[model samples]
Target: MMKVLLPVDGSEPSKNAILKGIEEGLLEGKEIHIITVVPGIVPVEGYILSPHVDDTNQQLAEETLTDAKALLADYPNVVAVTRKGDPGTEILHYASEIGADLIIMGHRGLGTFSKIFLGSVSSRVLNHSECSVYIVKS
Candidate 1:
């Protein structure tokens, strides 16, 4: 079975990527892995602000994965995962670990800068992924 890696961030583009993949018949008969990476919170002045921050981030990551999974309800071979780290790095690591045949993701995500041609995470993945990448634009 073909292994496809899909990284989402609960962004509209990311959701659209899933929808587009389904519409294009790209996810049929494939082992689809849906992942969401929560960026690690950095400490300031050698102290973390609040303990609940990590928990909140983790919850959000899981929610993101759940939402993505909902889009692929008909797909039997689907797995959802959550990771905490740099988004691009974690995505690449997961893809390599799974020996993915393809990576389908959005061209842009929920980032501060919307004017850029492509989101930083997507750009990094596009430039470095070992497998074929399909970028969906919203």
Candidate 2:
């Protein structure tokens, strides 16, 4: 069975990616790992003074993952994962860690500056991933 990584961010484009993957039979007899990256309240190496910020980030991550789980529950092969870090790097790392054959994700995430900074998570994955990458747009 093939393994496909579907990274979502609770965005319409990400939802489109999930739907597209299912419609294309990309998940047929395969493992579908759904990921949501929560950029931490502070960078990994940075100091965070506000516990409130940390709590908020955690809550948001849980809510986002819960929604993602509900959306993907109909697919027998799907699994949900939530992490904190750089979205593109973490997504790509998880795909490699899982030995995924394909990485399917949205064209862009929740950030606006991503387009100018790195284009998108999809772009970064396409450039850095060793596996095949499929980016869906809404």
Candidate 3:
């Protein structure tokens, strides 16, 4: 069976990507893995913030995965996972671990300036993934 990795971040584009995949029948009879990554917390001035922040991030990640799974409820071969780290790095790692054949993700279509300032996760995965990547633009 084909293994498809879907990385979502609770964005409209990500939701659209899932919908498009279903509409195109790309996920049928495939092993679908849906993942959401929460960035690792960083300390400020050598001091860490309250633990509530971390809890909140983790909760959000779980919620995102839950939402994605809900979208794919009709698909039986679907797995939802959550990770903590850089979104692009975690996505690549998960895909490699699962030996995914294809990755379907969303493109936020950030402006050049914003793209430069805030690195694009989709671009990173596309450029570095060992498997084919299908981008659903917003």
TM-score of each: 0.95, 0.84, 0.89
What would the per-residue lDDT of candidate 2 be over residues 32-115, giving only the tens digit for each residue?
Answer: 888878775555566656777767777777787787777677778777788889888898889889999998877787778754
* Candidate 1 structure quality by residue, lDDT tens digits, 41-128: 8879978589899989888888888888888999999999988899999999999999999999999999978877799999999999
Ranking by lDDT: 1, 3, 2
Residues 28-120 of candidate 3: C-alpha lDDT, one tens digit per residue: 999999989987988789776999999998988888889999999999999889888988899999999999999998875222444442238
Ranking of models by TM-score: 1, 3, 2
lDDT of each: 0.92, 0.79, 0.87
Report the number of the highest-TM-score candidate: 1
Q: In model 2, what are the clashing residue pairs, if there are any? A: none
Deviating ranges (above 4 Å) for candidate 1:
46-48
lDDT of 2 at 78: 73
Best of the two (1, 2) by TM-score: 1
After aligning candidate 3 to the native by TM-score, how far in Å is the CA of 17 from where it should be? 0.7
